[model samples]
Target: MKYYSTNGQVAPVSLEEAVVKGLAGDKGLFMPEKIATLSKSTIDGLKDKSFREIACTVARAFFGEDIEPDTLDALVKDTLSFETPVVPVRKNCYSLELFHGPTLAFKDVGGRFMARLLGYFIKKQGLNDVNVLVATSGDTGSAVANGFLGVPGIRVFVLYPKGKVSPIQECQFTTLGQNITALEVDGTFDDCQALVKNAFMDETLNNHMALTSANSINVARFLPQSFYYFNAYAQLDRMGKAGEMVVCVPSGNFGNITAGLFAARMGLPIKRFVAANNRNDVFLEYLNTGKYTPRPSVSTIANAMDVGDPSNFARILDLFKANEDVHKAICSKISAYRYTDEQIAQTMQTVYSETGYILDPHGACGYQGLIDSKLTATETGVFLETAHPAKFKETVDKILSSDIEIPAKLQAFMKGTKQSVELDKDFVGFKAFLLRQ
Candidate 1:
């Protein structure tokens, strides 16, 4: 399938080009020139299929004949080694456990899928090396690092704000050596994102290395994330609870919830979507006022969702036709709610006391969003638990008055020492560091 830029200035590109180039030359996110809507028959067939089979069908519809059938099958197999189960958290609330992957976060699915696809494309083009650039608040760095680690013909560079992410989140990225390198930017996530975007548009950097991205802005990252919505539905259906349900997503860059909306467009029986947010509530304000505005991000306990200006808002606009009237209808189906750090802590404690579910600060924000959105009556509301509670151990412990044991995977990570250089939030300084490296 061919992809086009949002601005209508750039020429269309093949799936190969879209996957490799990431952002279009016009500096817009790449979107399919045409979207293949799921037929009734396709949606009906998905009910009985395995998660892997369903993913293959959904992915193949958009991918067309771009990837080899066997290669795509193998990639799907490797990508879904862990299960994404929707478990009961309360009488009317469910929790989508998306932290089962290697990095223990929702980004794992996208990261693994992108890494494998990049590997396939590099092999096809006979290219020996490439650079993958990513900007992260928390989980994204580790997910991308682990996903691309030691993959032949690729080096992955992850940029994250220093002193913003959780301790475990930091370790998850810095501890990974080999093909993975982490950059600690002494700025907000917006700064890291800006630098990455500027680097992609830089003529010198583009000439020095073949630059790509693993952030949600990439089609690769955006597409694989649709699988969880499928898995959530399948799990609910298997439990004989297949009615229309609300999904509360703790949104940061808004990619995860947008992926869910994309699946709904593909015929998932979603009743509504709730964008659960922390201090950064641009989408929240947009949902309430129908006016898109920019603001500075406020640091919160749920640091990952602290995005004042989400890049994926472009895709959200494209989904709703970029018209205020159309967005009103879309907002009817999507409700946004922002929570405070105190509320998140209270919700975390309450869930631990009542349901025995230990939610990280981010998940607590999602839980609180559902309550604030007045979805307590909805029996099928599923709040996305994007990370393991241990990732934010200090916050979780202080809130719940309990200690979380580090998982074996995280324990192993402690053995690998961190290697990173602190950098000022300046493009010139960052560019110099990249040059020296």
Candidate 2:
């Protein structure tokens, strides 16, 4: 399938070019020329399939045109080795637990898939020195770093704010030694994202090395995320409770929710969406007033949702504005809500006390969104539990006043010593450093 730049200035390119370039020459994110819809029979049959089978079916639609069927099946199966189970949290509310992969965060699915896909492309094209530049507020850095760790012929540079990310999130990336470099930038998540975007646009840097992003801007990274949504539907269908399904995502860079939107567009039967936000509520502001004013992000308990300028907003805008009323289309399908740090903490505490389901700070935003929206009695709501609570051990412990046990997977990352290169968040400094490397 041909992928075109959202900006509409660049000509369409093949899957290989879109995956490799990550961003378009026009500085716009890539969008597929077509979104394939699954037949009713196929959608109904998903209930009998495993997560891998459901993913393979969904994967074939987005990727089969570009890849041989067997090869694509293998890639999908490998990327989804773990399951994203929809556990019932309340009467009709569920938690799509996505923190089951190596890094135990939602990005693990996209991060791992992009790593393998990029590896395949590099080996096929006989290219070396491919650099993956990612900027993360939290989980993304750990997920992408662990996903590409020790992968041959690829180097991942994780740029994150110096003192913004939780300690566990920092450990997950900084401790990895082979083929993964952590860049602790002295700025916010937006600053780190700017440095990565600028690096892609730099003439000298591009000439020096092959550069691509693992951020949701890359189709390879975000498209695979649609797999779980289909699987979630299947899981709900099997339970005989696949009523009006509404998904609430704790919006960060908007990649995760954008992927869900793509699933809905592909006829996954998603009734609507709710975007949960923390203090950085630019997207919510956009939804309320129909004005997109990007601003600097503020620190919040839900650090992962601390994105002021979400990169995938362009993709969402393009997806809805395709020959229709843009604001009306988006507003109709997506409800927006924002929460304060106190509200997030309160939700986490209340959910734990009432249901014994531990809500990560990010997931707290999602849970609260559904609660605030006042879902219909027949609507089945699933909020993405984006990461394990232990990733934010300090915050969780403080909020609940109870010590939570860290998972063995996270403990392993913590055992390793930290190693990172600190740099000023200025683009000039970032460019000079990349050029030297």
Candidate 3:
């Protein structure tokens, strides 16, 4: 399949080129030239299929022409070692638990898929010293670092804001000593993201090392996320509630929801979408006023959703720009709601008290978006529980007045001593650091 840059400044490239070159020359996200729609019968038949079968079907749509069938099937099977179950939390409401992976975050789906795909391309071309640059708010660092850890010929540099991420989230990546190296930047998530983008466009850095991103900005990372959306629909289809299904996403960088938009284009039968935002609500503002103004992000209980300038917003705009009235095109299909730290805390407490269901701060936003949504009696809602509540155990414990049990996966990470290289959030300094390596 041919992939086109959303900015339209470059020629169309193959899927391999799109995956390897993370960002376009014009600083746009890579978008597939064609959105292949599945047959209605195929969509209805998904309920009877396993997650691997459903994922292979969807993966075939995006990558079948580029990759051989058996190789692609193996990649899908290896990437998805766990199931993303849609659990019932309330009447007509469900939580698509995505925290079952190694990192216990939704980015695991994309991160692992991208890692295997990149490794395949590297080995195919006999490449060497392929450096992956990823910027994280909180969970992304852990997801990407753990995903690419120990992969031959690939070195992962995880740049994250210092003292911003949760202690548990920090341990997951910083403690993993392998091909992964975490860079502690003394700034916000936007600063870390800027450093990565700057490194990608720098001619000197590109000449020095093969630089690529594992952030949602990468086509390989975010596109694979659509697999879970199809799986969620299949799970809902089994319950006879897929007729008027509304899926709410706890959105941060907009990549997760962008994948959903891609799934909808590919005929997922979703009624519409709701984007849940924390205090850093740039996308929500765009939905309300049609003005996309990005500023500095503020720290919140739901640290993962704390993104001010989302890179995928460009792709969202470009996706709708091709149709009539860009703003109208997007607003018609998406509804957005923003929440404060207090509101997020209230949700985590109330939901646990009422239903005995734990909600992390990010998932709280998604759950509340559905609660506020004026859905019809027959409409069913599924909000993505993006991460495990224990990830932010300090905040979750304080809110619920209880100490949550940290899973063995997280506990193992905490046992190791952290090793990181601290740096200022400046491009020149970052370039010099990489040049030294």
What are the lDDT figures for the candidates, one per model?
Answer: 0.86, 0.92, 0.93
lDDT of candidate 3 at residue 368, scale 0 to 100: 97
The estimated TM-scores of all candidates read 0.96, 0.99, 0.99
Per-residue lDDT of model 3, residues 158-206, tens digit only = 9999999999999999999889999999999999999998898899999
Q: Which ten residues in a row have the lowest lDDT in candidate 3?
A: 315-324
Q: Which sections of candidate 3 miss by over 4 Å?
A: none
- Native-to-model Cα distance after best TM-score fit, residue 17 in candidate 1, in Å: 0.7
Q: Per-residue lDDT of 71-139 in model 1, one digit per residue for the tens?
A: 788888888888888878877678899999998899999999999998889999999889999999999
TM-score of 2: 0.99
lDDT of 3: 0.93
Q: After superposition, how far is residue 310 of candidate 3 from its true place, in Å?
A: 0.7
lDDT per residue (tens digit) for residues 1-437 in model 2: 89999888989999999999999998999999899999989999999999999988998999989899999888877888789999999999999999999999999989989988998999999998899999999998998898898998899999999999999999999999889999999999999999988888889999999999999989999998898899899999999878689999999999999999999989999999999999999998998898999999999889999999999999999988865679988999999899999999999999999999899999999999998889998999999999999999999999999899999999999999999999998898888888888
Q: What is the lDDT of candidate 2?
A: 0.92
Instruction: Give the residue spans of candidate 2 off by over 4 A.
Output: none
Model 2, poorest ten-residue lDDT window? 320-329
RMSD over all Cα atoms, model 3: 0.8
lDDT for 49 in candidate 3 is 98
C-alpha positional error of residue 94 in candidate 3 after TM-score superposition, expressed in Å? 0.5
